[model samples]
Target chain A: MTPRIAIQEESFDLAAETARLTAGRQDVGGLASFVGLCRADDGLAAMVLEHYPGMTERAIARIAGDATGRWPLLGLTVIHRVGRLEPGAPIVLVLTASAHRAAALESCAFLIDWLKTGAPFWKREEFEGGAERWVEAKAADDAAAARWTPA
Target chain B: MRVLYFAWVRQRVGMAEEEISPPPEVRDVAGLVDWLSGRSDGHAAAFANRKTIRAAVNQDFAGPDHPVAAGDEVAFFPPVTGG
Candidate 1:
């Protein structure tokens, strides 16, 4: 199987990632993807992402595993970038492939939703005037992830 | 035991990682937090609001009541805000 998880500082090629996921696989009928970008809020200059070296990967892999178990996913790819990033830069990508669109779409959503709260990454935003602050977690994100809880 | 801090927690604590031995009464995450908070003003400030802090034991998400022992890695940070 192709590598399903990547945590790196370099940018990734979406086309290449898609090709790799479907390579030699005629079973994949649908693909869903989500890309997260750094936002340039008022006075925002840069955003820096920090993560625990070993725990970050483990947390993401556990989230991917949970998605795979809940959905009929044929393939999955999760890429998260670390280090300083400018506004408009891609920060995360979640791509899911399955035999049908519903599974692909829902699983893609599930992956990103879980990743938002469950992953170990922390973001610090730097404003134009040399002020920096750690971004606070949103209750909305927790609510979003909570919806997927087993009934 | 290794205690790690991240994000603003590290900034407030003034260090990223530290090695220390806690008293026997500090047997779980909450107890550890209480003990650390008393060590210095920085730690006290960082841990002032327990509601905003989160913990992980041995790379797994944990609760305040989670049991902790020697030779374990415990990390504390603010709630995660990643995508």
Candidate 2:
């Protein structure tokens, strides 16, 4: 069976991941996937992602578990890359499969939203002149995650 | 206890991890932060803005009031910005 969560320095193949999740699975009628890329905004040359090793995996698994609890998902996958990445490289991926489109699509969206704020990964940007700075968390990302919380 | 730092917090703190024994009065995350702030200028600078600093006790997200004891693994970091 394909692993549901992966945190690695190497990149991933979306097509292969999708096939592995749905291959020979007739019950899955909908599969939604989201891929996040590193943008070369401003004079950016590269981006470095740092994470708390053991905590990163545990935190992601917890979030993935929450998604499964909230939706009738047949399968789910979350891949996040760490270390140094060039502009345009893929940073993260979220795939959700279910019997219907609604569950798969909504769960996929929910996973990414929660991952943005809940995961223990940090991003540092390297500019063209060799200057580097850590990326600041956005309040909007927190708000996005908050929308799912019970009032 | 073992304390770890990440991202900008790590950068400002000048090291990734450290071993420290806090005084008994340091019973919680906020108290620990106050004690750690006196260790050095780097730590004080890293935690200058309390709102920007986040913490984890034994790898789980923790708040200021979270109690911390000896032999625990505590981590200090900035708000995460990952997708």
TM-score of chain B taken alone, every candidate: 0.98, 0.98
DockQ for all models, in order?
0.90, 0.91
**Ten-residue stretch with the least lDDT total in model 1 chain A:** A1-10
Q: Best by DockQ, which number?
A: 2
lDDT of all the models against the reference? 0.94, 0.94
* Model 1 Cα lDDT, one tens digit per residue, A29-59: 9999999999999889999999998999999
Clash pairs, candidate 2, are: none
State every prediction's TM-score relative to the real structure. Answer: 0.98, 0.97
Per-prediction count of colliding residue pairs?
0, 0
Off by over 4 Å in 1: A1-3
* Tens digits of per-residue lDDT for model 2, A1-151: 2338999999999999999898887999999999999998998999999999999999999988888888989999999999999999999999999999999999899999999999899999999999988899998999999998989
Candidate 2, DockQ score (0 to 1): 0.91
lDDT of 1 by residue, B1-83 (tens): 99999999999999999999998888999999999999999999999999989999999999999999999999999999899
